[model samples]
Target: STVLLTGANGFIAATILRKLLERGHTVVGTVRSESKATFLREQFKAAVDSDKLKFAVVDDITAPGAFDEVLRAYQFDAVLHTSSPFRYNITDIDEELLQPAIQGTTGILDSVNRVAPSVKRVVVTSSFASVVNRTKGTWPGKVYTEADWNPTTREEGLKDVGSGYYASKTLAEQAAWDFVKEKNPRFTLTTLCPPMVYGPPEQEVPSMVKLNVSNLDIYDIFNGASDPRYGVWVWIDVRDLAEAHVLAWCDAAIAANQRYIVSQGNFSPQMFVDYIWKHYPERAAAKGINKHSPGKYYSDEGIYGVDTSKSVKDLGMKYTPIEDMLRDTLKRFEDLEAEGK
Candidate 1:
């Protein structure tokens, strides 16, 4: 299969690309600039040499016909759209979060419908923020599934960065469903929503200071800068996520226009501290891991749970344990630190 993966240089997308390439699929990754395209080629020189990977540039996903040329050029069997603004620090909520997310999603679908009729499936990367009402405190014993939708308005998103990101994901995913219903596109659409994704980086990172947003949160916990008071307590390894994307794309028997929640399990910073203190005592002592009280960093009793049975049953997905996730991630962190990154 030939897959068109948007944001292929991103942390998740890069892993997905690697998985697809390993499965002998031809991959055309879309980046926003020539420099990034060059970087991807150099990074995946083996795949490029084997003619298994190629790249295209789409400067703006929100522009009308932004993906038209690229879609028209490739005979893509599937598309994995993972390109959208996700930074917590936003200057303009509409410009940064809402517009790009909403427009970028619809634009890709529109282009695929118009130009890439051969494409059979499209997978989008949504978030748990789209389903959970985060404004209210976490509800204990409340198990969230794909049936839930966040009831947030643009005005509500404008109030803060986190809320705004929630609104963006909710509305963007909503727009995707609406487009399929109204436009009646030929390809099946599936959305995957994972909360608090963490794992080792697959894409290049110049420095720890410039780590991606999701990984940055994990790093903060190690450095004891992140407050457990604001923890979400759910996580999925990136490797598991990358496999889920492939399974979702390949499985056509499952219903279309469906959403799947992919998660490993619940977690908190205190658990990470405990793991570090037990496994890497010297490093933990050097980093002052036990300086803070673990009780304060644990998830509140009212924290909610997510149902991931659909992914496991339908896609044959298996999750990695949180302990393994922390160990692998910390190993990568230490390697990067040794390199002065």
Candidate 2:
């Protein structure tokens, strides 16, 4: 099968690209620039040489007909759209975050429906931001599933940066479902909403400074931050999330038009800090790492729970343990530090 992977240079997309290739699928990845294309080519030189991997540039995904050219050129069997703005440090919430996210998503769907009729399955990387309603706070005793939706309005989303990001995801995902229902496109849509993806990146990390947003939290702890501010407790390993995307694409019959909340389970900052301190005592001592008291800040009852039963039963999803996730993640950071990156 030939797959078109959007935002191929991103943290999650990079791993998804690797998984697709391993499954004997030819991939055409889209990046924003030529440099990004070159970097991926270098990363997968063997695949490129064997004509198993290729790249295209789509500079502005928010622009009208952003994906029209690419969709017309390739006979794509499936599309894994993972490109969207995920940054928080910005001035204009609507321009920098909301519009791009909403438009980029709908733009691709329009293109696939209008031009790429060969596309049978389309998997989108929507975030858990679209699943959990922050206004509800902890929502004690409530278990969140694929059916839950973040009730963030466009007006409220414009109030703050965090809300803006959450709104972007929610609105974009909503737009996707709406498009399919109204347009009746040839392709079936599947959206994987995973919380706090963390794992060693499949692509090369230029430096610790350039680590993805989720991995940056771990780096802060390693860099000797006394407080590990735990936010959303649910998480999924990058590898597992990538596998979920591939499974969502391959098993078209079961995954058709489904929204899956992919998660390993719950975790806290204290859990991660304690694990590092216990396993790498020497490094912990050298870096002056402070381990928060066990169970001091986290409680299963205080936060909302996640139900991944749909993902497991439907996609045959299996998750990496928290300890293994931390080990490989920290090792990757250490390797980068050792190389002065």
Candidate 3:
């Protein structure tokens, strides 16, 4: 099947791209930079040069039908919308975060509307951001599931309404669902939401540029900062997340406007620290840091967890065990330091 993935060369999306290639699907990924696309061509050269993979430049989402030219020309069978602006802090919050997120959804769906019959399914990389917030984002002590929405509307006040990224995603997802129901297009749409996603880097970007990463977020948990507004914890392996994307696209039963919480298990930063201390004592201590950061850092329980039952039940995806996934991730981080990539 011919597949199109927006934000093709991102951390998690790169994994999804690799999985799609392994399955023998024809892939054409959209990148904002032709130079980055050239790097992808080398990394996935066999696919790119062999005509199994292609790249298109799409620099703006607010551009009407940002992907229309490519979508119309290629006749893709599936589309994965994996690109979104991620920011911890935004000066012009609405433009940087909201515009791409909410507007990007509109643009992608517009392309689908333009080519509804040709596109079989569209998978959106959403977040648990759609479900809860950091402080009183949802409830004081609840594990968010597919049934829950952010519930933290504009009425809730922004002091502790969590990050702007949450606002962007929650609003964007709601808007997408509204559009899907109103239009009732032929294609199926599914949103895969994960939280606190942590894993090793997949590709090399400019060493000068640093994206706010999950691994570092976890590291911050060890430094004694806790947000007491949540209790449900959720984490997913990068590789497993890639595989789940495949299942989301290939499975017939997963359909339009459905949301799947694509998490493997739940863990607080404290518990995850303890987990590493027990399993990987040497590595943890070797980093010139305390191996355990339980009570000092996070609460015994926090609202960072999610229920993976729905994804497991419906998609038949078997998530990798937490220990193995973390072990490999840390090792890869060390390997990067060694190679200085």
Candidate 4:
């Protein structure tokens, strides 16, 4: 299969690109710049040398028909769109978060519909934000599935960065489904909604400052910047999430035009802290990492539960244990530190 992966240099997309190549698929990855393309080429030298991996630059995904040129250039069997912004430190919510996410998604779909009839499947990296209801504040009995939709309005999104991100994901995914129904494109769509993805990145990290958002949350624990207690405990390993994308793309049996919630179940900041303390005791002690009373900060009281049964049953998903994920993540950080990065 020939696949097009947008945001190929991203933390998650790097792993997806790797899995796609390992599965014997030719991949054309889209990055924002040639520097990123060079970085990816270095990261996957064998793939690039073998002509299994290639890259194209799509500088601004928000622009109208941002993907048209790329779509027309490649004979793509499928596409994995993971190019939306996820930052929160922005002033203009509409410009930074909303417009890019919505337009980037719709633009790609429109471009594919118009130019790439050979493309049969489109998989999007939607967020758990789209499936979570913020208003409920973790309704105790609520078991969130793919069926749930975050009812964040545009007005609510404009209020703050967090709300804006949630609303952006919700509205963008909504627009995707709406486009499929209204336009009836030749291809089918699959969206994966995963929560708080965490793992070692397959791409190059020049410094700790360059860490992706979710991995940054883990780094903060040692840096003394994180609160001991946090909510929305669900998360997935990046490798697992990447596999889910590949599985969703190739498996025809997995229903199309549906959202899959890919999660490894519940977790808390304390759980991460505990794991580090137990495994890397020296580093934990050096960093003065608190071994927050076992399970004290973790509770099911105010947090919602996630059901990954659908993903497991449908995509044949299997989760990477938290221990392994943390170990690899910490090891990656150690390597970076040794390199003085």
**Top of the candidates by TM-score:** 2
Model 3 misplaced stretches (Cα beyond 4 Å) = 137-141, 154-162, 208-212, 218-232, 275-286, 292-305
Query: How far off is residue 323 in model 3, in Å?
Result: 1.0
Residue range 261-327, candidate 4, lDDT tens digits: 9999877778788877778788888888777786664454666789999898888999998889998
- The whole-model C-alpha lDDT of candidate 3 against the native structure comes to 0.73
Q: Decide which is better by lDDT, 1 or 3.
A: 1
The stretch of ten residues in a row with the least summed lDDT in candidate 4 is 222-231
- Report the C-alpha lDDT of model 1 over 1-341, residue by residue, as the tens digit: 99999998898998898899889999999999878777578878999998899889899899999999988887999999999887887889999889999999999999999989999999999988888877565678888899998999889988988888999999999999999999999999999998888889878788887788988876766765653435576789999999988998776458367799999867766777677667787766776655456445544475788899998888888999988888899899889888888
For each candidate, the alpha-carbon lDDT, in order, equals 0.85, 0.90, 0.73, 0.88
RMSD of 2: 1.3
- Which residues of candidate 2, in runs, are more than 4 Å off? 295-297
Ordered from best to worst lDDT, the candidate numbers read 2, 4, 1, 3
Clashes of each: 0, 0, 11, 0
Per TM-score, what order, best first?
2, 4, 1, 3
RMSD vs true structure, all candidates: 1.8, 1.3, 3.5, 1.4
TM-score of each: 0.95, 0.97, 0.87, 0.96
- Count of backbone collisions within predicted model 3: 11
lDDT of 4 at 104: 91
lDDT, model 2, position 125: 95
Please give the distance, in angstroms, between residue 283's alpha carbon in candidate 3 and its true position after superposition.
5.6
RMSD, candidate 1, Å = 1.8
Residues 94-176 of candidate 3: C-alpha lDDT, one tens digit per residue = 67777788899878987888764688788888888787655563343676788888754533323332456777788888878
